[model samples]
Target chain A: MTLDLDTARRLIAGTRSAAHERGLKPLTVVVLDAGGHVVAAEREDGSSAKRFEIAHGKAYGAVSMGLGSRALMDRAEQQPYFIAAVTSAVGGSLVPVPGGVLVRDGDGTLLGAVGVTGDTSDNDEAAAVAGIGAAGLTAQPAA
Target chain B: MTLDLDTARRLIAGTRSAAHERGLKPLTVVVLDAGGHVVAAEREDGSSAKRFEIAHGKAYGAVSMGLGSRALMDRAEQQPYFIAAVTSAVGGSLVPVPGGVLVRDGDGTLLGAVGVTGDTSDNDEAAAVAGIGAAGLTAQPAA
Candidate 1:
């Protein structure tokens, strides 16, 4: 089933909760449905102005490429030109970063994606994983 | 002064409350700082996928023109070519229509803007005005 607004808000809250527990920097979180449309989003106070776009791009990339952004990062490293072209194809809304995670259901059905920005990329990934876990879903960060 | 995240959330809540009280359709709301950066944004469950972009464009257009989108609409009708060129100049992020209201402080300082979409444009503008009022800010929908 497609992600719903209630679940999207929960995902956003869980992401922020994880960041708060870790004492990480204020973050921006974005939840996108399987079709890469935003379901919900929030930016904590003090986050940089561009964090929303960065967070949205990460999640959009995950859904558009059908892979976690960590894998996208690997591909980018191996084939920069290819990634660049794909990024252009997506209207420059792809970020090859680790903070973007794919969400899946028990039946291995892709539900949506969550993207986080604020802390280091790895830390952001950790937060995203925690959020997905908190939402009772699986987070795929690579492969 | 710039609009903070807390106030932005309040405005969003207020906008939704107004829509609910009036039994309006599901809506998308966007808050943008004076610099035209997103502070916060949300789309209700049933809103169309592109509501966020439309809402954002309404607010961005208001702040960019230093007037409410109602005025922008008037200018667009009076000078279609100019509005069209300006829309292209802003990367096509300007929506000349109602439902985009400028936010101002007591001292008449421009703080930010709010955009709403889903219902009729007039109803959307009403909700936006209600939201700004709830946040204790003034809403300028014309001039």
Candidate 2:
């Protein structure tokens, strides 16, 4: 099923709850549709102004590359030039990091992605996973 | 005072209400801080994939130029080369148009700007105005 606005909002709520529980720094969360388009995005009050773009880039990259951003990070280390070129190719929305998690259905269908920022990359990924789980979906963050 | 996330979300809600009341097409709304950075953004379910970029550009142009985008539209018409140059200088986030309205405080202090897209330019501006008013803020659209 498509990622609707209600589900996207629920994801953001869950992400925020996770961050709050762990006392993470202020965060920005972005939810993207399968087409890599923003469905909803929210930035915490004290978050740096650039957080939205960074978070959006993370989600967009995950959805566009068809791989979790963590895998993209591994690929980036092996082929930095290729990742850099793809970043340019996507108009600078590809941020290879752990925070971008791919959303998937039970049968392995891609739904969309959720991106989180303003914490450590691992924390961000954990928060994204919590969010997707809260929405009753699976998160396919690559190893 | 900085524009908080709650206020920004309220603004978006009001914007959507206005668009819905007017029977406008699916819309995207973007809220930017005084620094011309996104605080929040949302794309309607059926909005085009490009709507977020366009809305953000409109708001960024308004906040960056210190004038509503309607005035920027006029300036663009009178000095296309200058506007074009500025657009490139801002990393292509300047969209000179009517849908961008400046947010202001009672004493005329600049707050931020909101951009709406998906309807006619005039209609979009109207929705922005309605949203700002709904949030108990003033809307400054350059004459």
Candidate 3:
């Protein structure tokens, strides 16, 4: 239920390495705890104003759904009427897309999550996977 | 940095899972892209409206400064005037407090950031970290 600062640092470092390996463009990473609260956040220079919100939303959507944004998007597609109505009702923070997942210990203990932006969802997902492994945790694939 | 739909879901899924496991109250998680734009967002059904803005502002601040909210809060202490000015200048999307970190990659690429506010700073950071890992990225430490 708790996240350590040392672990968080490792998570970021791992993500950075993965991104560079792939030669992805500038990216932003975020960490959230199990309680669905903010843990750590960052933005890169030249990142647009909207980028901040977009990153947050992408990750938020993934965290909220307990699945990758792409999976959620697929679910939303199956129920367009409900999804559209929910989006309209919620206004902000409800994103239907891919590129996010859940972080769990080997025993399936919850350990919070990580989100990445500034690239394709596939790349973002790839980076997230890399970070989770660096942190010594497991990334549950989208269902 | 560009924020996409895939990463959005990852952030939310991790955050929510953390909350669900920890028995924290219902929460609203928000992720912001590098440009401060909303890439994805999600609020727990029982969460209040206040959570939405708090999450947005905190995440926005993290991305805006390329650091976590906790780090930003510390800096604000040294320059209260500047922090206050930013709050007033950019309303509803800049909570200068602890709990959020800047999103970054291994090579220090700027992607996007995330923010959460349903719990304390520590809890917030936890959720943020969970989100980051869920997305396969890393969150920077508060400097």
Q: RMSD for each model, in Å, please?
A: 1.4, 1.6, 11.7
TM-score, second chain, candidate 2: 0.95
Give each prediction's DockQ, rounded to 2 decimals.
0.57, 0.58, 0.09
**Tens digit of per-residue lDDT, candidate 1, span A74-136:** 999999998889988887589998999999988889999999999999999999999999999
lDDT tens digits by residue: candidate 3, A1-143? 24544465567668768888998876666665565444454444344555554655666666665666677678788987865676566555755655465678889876766767778877877887888898889885365
Chain B TM-score of every predicted model: 0.97, 0.95, 0.88
CAPRI grade, predicted model 1:
medium
Docking class of 3: incorrect
Residues B3-63 of candidate 2 have per-residue lDDT tens digits of 7899889999999998999899888999988898788888888888889889998898998
Clashing pairs in 2: none
Interface Cα RMSD in Å, per prediction = 2.3, 2.3, 9.4
Q: How far is candidate 2 from the true structure (C-alpha RMSD, Å)?
A: 1.6
Off by over 4 Å in 2: none
Task: Arrange candidates, best TM-score first.
Answer: 1, 2, 3
Is 1 or 3 the stronger prediction by DockQ?
Answer: 1
The DockQ for candidate 2, computed on C-alphas, is: 0.58
Preferred candidate (lDDT higher): 1 or 2: 1
lDDT of 3 by residue, B1-143 (tens): 36555566677778778778777776767766676765555556455545766877888887777778888788788998888887777665577776565666667776777777676778777877866776778886375
lDDT of 3 at A60: 66
